[model samples]
Target: MTESLDDTALDRLFRTARTRNGWTDRPVAEALLRQVYDLAKMGPTSANVSPARFVFVASAAAKARLAPHLSNTNRPKALAAPVCAIVAFDLDFAQRIPELFPNNPGAQAWFADPKVAEVTAFRNGSLQGAYLMLAARALGLDCGPMSGFSQSGLDAEFFAGTSWRSNFLCSLGYGSDENLFPRNPRLAFEDACRVL
Candidate 1:
């Protein structure tokens, strides 16, 4: 088994990570975004459905298209971010089960129920979004994940005819520490966890 990560690495990935509201002028290269996804896609998922997909908006026109869907508070931050990622999931993700979980030919049947598929897509897709953030963070990029946006509007604007639906949005870049909202309190271990 691999050794556990050191505290510094842990801090960088979790403890010290903040939801940034502002970013630097430095551009985030498209290649870096590809690298981050390469890291994130390695993380596990149920049935290996791997439902998460992303659209990195760096172009002015794309960002402008996305702006109207964002809340007033998030609009400015989205505009300032070097790259804004639209994390989405395919509604028919289970169809890829045969390719992703090859050994189990019946894997697709397991999620055949529409309701079950819906839950799995949203749950696992959201997990993949978390993985995406960690990968970006590990690559020296700061992440600001926010949900203050119109999912319907975004879906219509970006995924109108596609099976993909927006799960969440994360802004990526070298963030300005000056832009942080004071770190909020988190539940203590005893309050948030349980050990049987």
Candidate 2:
């Protein structure tokens, strides 16, 4: 049986972790980015559909391409961040099911309908994005995840002619604690969950 994570691990991953609003000048190395993805990819998804794609905007030219599409509030953070990742989803991810789930060749047929594909891609993709954030934090990086952006423009500029579409944006770097706001309260377990 698997053991529960210790207090320090829990705190590092959730209890005391804060969303980054700004970052220090420290850079996020490419190797670390690869490591982050390697860990996050292991997180489970329905039928292993694994639709999420990420674009690490580490260069000024790439960040410039993304800036105009972000909301005013997100623009400065995106610019200030060492890397702004575009967390996207593939609208045609089901095509890979035969490879990812070879034991169940019939699984690909489940998402043949556009509606089912949409829902499954979205649901699994969003989960992958969350896993990415957790993996980043575990690797000692910080994250600022945002959804206030022009999705169409991002998709048009960054994912043009590709099946990938924007889901959200995440800025990654070493956070400046001086830039953090007061921690917000979360719903109590009883208020947000149930044993039944």
Candidate 3:
């Protein structure tokens, strides 16, 4: 087994993560995408339900299919990015919860109700999506996460026959400094945190 690593690299990765708007006209290889998934899948989820699924739209035809689903504000950036990921959640995630949460009996039953399924799908999918962004950043890729797309349109166009449902869209590529928005001010740590 390999020795444990230090935390400095993780801290730097988080600190340096930026929401990129402009991208270089370079392709993100499938190998890199696989590596990103390998890292992201390690993140913890409720009962390890692991609902998030990704569809990497890199072909011209796929991009064309995705274009119509994006909002006017996001279309340009979406088209420019090397890869656009359709982040989704499987409706039947509970079926695999037993394997994911082997230590806990009846864990899968927690999401058996219709209302619980909806809640778990969105919540765990969102968490996994965030892990994806961090993983991409760690792999030296820039990300533009957007929610401006028409989710219903995406579902109809790309996920019509699948159990997967759209959660959000993320564009990944090599970013350019030319088109970045000015960094906005953030709440101070004290103001944003509360210790009980």
Give a tens-digit lDDT track for model 2, residues 1-196: 5999999989989989898888899999999999999999999999899999999999999988998999998899888999999999998999999999899978999999998998899899999999999999999999999988999999999999998989999999998975689998889999999997
TM-score of 3: 0.91
Residue pairs in collision within model 2:
none
Question: Model-by-model lDDT, in order?
Answer: 0.93, 0.93, 0.89
| Collision count of model 3 | 0
lDDT for model 1 comes to: 0.93
Task: Put down candidate 3 lDDT per residue, 1-196, tens digits, no spaces.
Answer: 4964457666536655678889999889999999999999999988788999999999999999999999998999989999999999998888887788889858888878978997898899999999999899888899999999998899999989888899989999999985788877889989999988
Ranking, lDDT, top scorer first: 1, 2, 3
Candidate 3 Cα errors over 4 Å, as ranges:
1-12
C-alpha TM-score for every candidate = 0.97, 0.97, 0.91
Worst 10 residues of 2 by lDDT: 177-186
Query: Which regions of candidate 1 deviate over 4 angstroms?
Result: none
**Judged by TM-score relative to the true structure, which candidate is superior, 1 or 3?**
1
Clashes of each: 0, 0, 0
lDDT of 3: 0.89
Per-residue lDDT tens digits for candidate 1, residues 20-138, read: 99999899998999999999999899978899989999999999999999999899999899999999999899888888999996889988888888889899999999999999999
